[model samples]
Target: MVLDAYASSNPDQVHEDVLQKSRDACYKARDAFYSCLEKESGKKPTEIASVGLLYPKECSLSRTEFVKSCRSSWGPETRGGILEKPYTFSSSSSKFVLLISDVSGGDLFMLEFMHMMTKLRPFVHSFLKEASKMFVLYIYTMGDRPYSRQMAKLLDPKGEYFGERIISRDDGTVRHQKSLDVVLGQEKAVLILDDTENAWPSHKDNLIVIERYHFFASSCKQFDHRFQSLSLLKSDESEPDGALATVLKVLKQTHSLFFEDGGEDLSGRDVRSLLKQVRKEILKGCKVVFSRVFPTKSQAEDHPLWRVAEGLGATCATEVDESVTHVVAVDVGTEKVRWAIREKKFVVHRGWIDAASYLWKKQPEENFGLEQLKKQGTDEKSDDVNI
Candidate 1:
């Protein structure tokens, strides 16, 4: 409210100063208001920030115009309407492609359909800065119009990244699923980053599946997860070496390949195929075989590890052959492990494949060796005995 007032008072400079200047002004206003309330109610200022409802009497008198204007502008009827439209950068010559998602970029937690708290994924701002350079960035989220606009304000306050290309739940097609049919660009050029794969079932080829970011307890609870939230743990995903970082590198490569390598014909290029090819090269030139990795009754090709290995561009086989490069096993005593050792092939735990899948890079074989697995098993057994 204070920041809004400051923006209204300095309409000419608000665009450039809202982030820093208005932030400072809001903090000062909050402090003064809370101090005044605390003196009247005999409560701590810290508690006032959280759940205090007392309005500062001085602010009511001093900021009467601002409050009156705000009330008139944001009355019950006007509040639900669209705040802003999608913006287009006239200087950008690149082919405009839309990015649609619900969870990949950020997650919003709602309390009783009234208050909302948003937690942006790590490196999101950096990702947007980089992505905006390559594609005409558009945000299509399932959140409501007001909430989406609020998130956009935090993400691209200067309005340089995502002009008016924001689409909210109110703009969605029937069944509440995101559809590229409404997007102005060609379907082949659009690339979507979303955590829920099924949400874009029709556009799976264009969709890049990302791991969901769960920061708050409410977010985890919404997904029916019982694990501790990142907020409660006081830790977040690594900013430098995190999911968004990896995704940005992929986007850069895709954009470069799309514009530079794909020749002058921009319409013929598709980022989805480029992304698939890039992912395939992560574990290329390797043959992986699993021993005792899956249950005896389970189909070798149907196993999760097999799918992960194949997805990473590694050929998965049931038997250790001369072409095999790595033997993934749980126990070092397995016959395939001995065979791999005899053939001088890399014998590693299943975690090596899993790590490569998650990191999108070939993990060091030394870090996932049978010795490490043996030590882990020993430690587990010792702990069990102690129990």
Candidate 2:
């Protein structure tokens, strides 16, 4: 009330021309960025502008301007991901603004969320068919409403997949990050498949990180990766072994474990607990050998990565043998790496194992190939160091 009276007493302070103009510019930038979000709800989020600010690849240009124009006084409300002030979007259909009449009653929220991945990913129908058997599927994303609904049609032309269970940015009650509260299912039974990990900080345990598909060159440059995208290179993950397939395997396992007893009483099962075992099986039954990855003075078994590989259910061996399925190394000329390459086994960089650990799923070995070198390996004994 004091501030209101002060503003009335001092109209000059409240009507400052420069401050009002700056705020107008900020609001315009915010609206444009958000409009882009509304239009490209089908795209996966790849461009991470900051710690919690991740948006679809198509919103890159507008996001930069939004940040640049609004870096001044906008507070991070953790709701709309805005930086300056209370972000208010009035729907053209109903201008009924949600001015909180009661804060203690857990005030209603008009959370800005969009069901991203609005389109059916490659092989999505099959995955959904299998997933629908064990889990209720929901398409929760950071996208606009009209585009989101349009993409939903593209993803589910016959309305068989998500039905009316689509959750868009406009459907959310929280801001900045996405939450499972928007979902009707309990947190224990819900599993999320998203590429951006931090977008849902409150529910990392339920998240299953999926490999991003950058089908365009413009998408690759936004992430600033040193290498070109698979699409630009005239290749992509094989359909049978791509992320959708890999995650399908994980989901099926989770389903099996959740109902392993066959008693049908699901009150005792928690997917979060079963995920640990499922993740361990990512590299199961594989024997791995490492070379030139650890210091000469350190024990190979004592290295951190050795533990990571072991934790992923891969048996670590120092020697190249018939049993070794993978050779993890930094240098392509290493004895073990060369042996694995010659024997048609997987020769992968340390990042391959690290990726598996971080992603909770085995990454493609092709993406983690060791950097090729010009020198030929010095002649060593036959690959069969021991049986």
Best by lDDT: 1
Off by over 4 Å in 1: 1-92, 98-100, 103-116, 174-176, 217-229, 261-263, 293-298, 302-305, 330-334, 337-351, 366-387
Q: Which residue window of length 10 is worst by lDDT in model 2? A: 97-106
Model 1: per-residue Cα lDDT over 1-387, one tens digit each: 987687568676666665787889878976775564444334454442232121212333322243244444432222111113232222125544748465344433222133334556777888788777677677778877765665666567698877656777766664668777555455556678777777776887787777677776667789965456776676778878887787777777776776665344454556778878887898899999877777666688997678878877998888767999998876666688888889999988877886676567899999999788676553111111100
CA deviation > 4 Å runs, candidate 2: 1-120, 284-311, 314-347, 354-369, 372-387
Q: Candidate 2, residues 75-159: lDDT per residue as tens digits? A: 3321111011232211111111010000010011111333122123466667666666555556776766554555555555587
After superposition on all C-alphas, the RMSD of every candidate to the true structure, in Å, is 15.6, 16.5
Q: Cα miss at 94, model 2 (Å)?
A: 40
What local distance difference test score does each model get? 0.65, 0.58
Whole-structure CA lDDT of model 2: 0.58
* Per-prediction TM-score: 0.63, 0.52
Who wins the TM-score comparison? Answer: 1
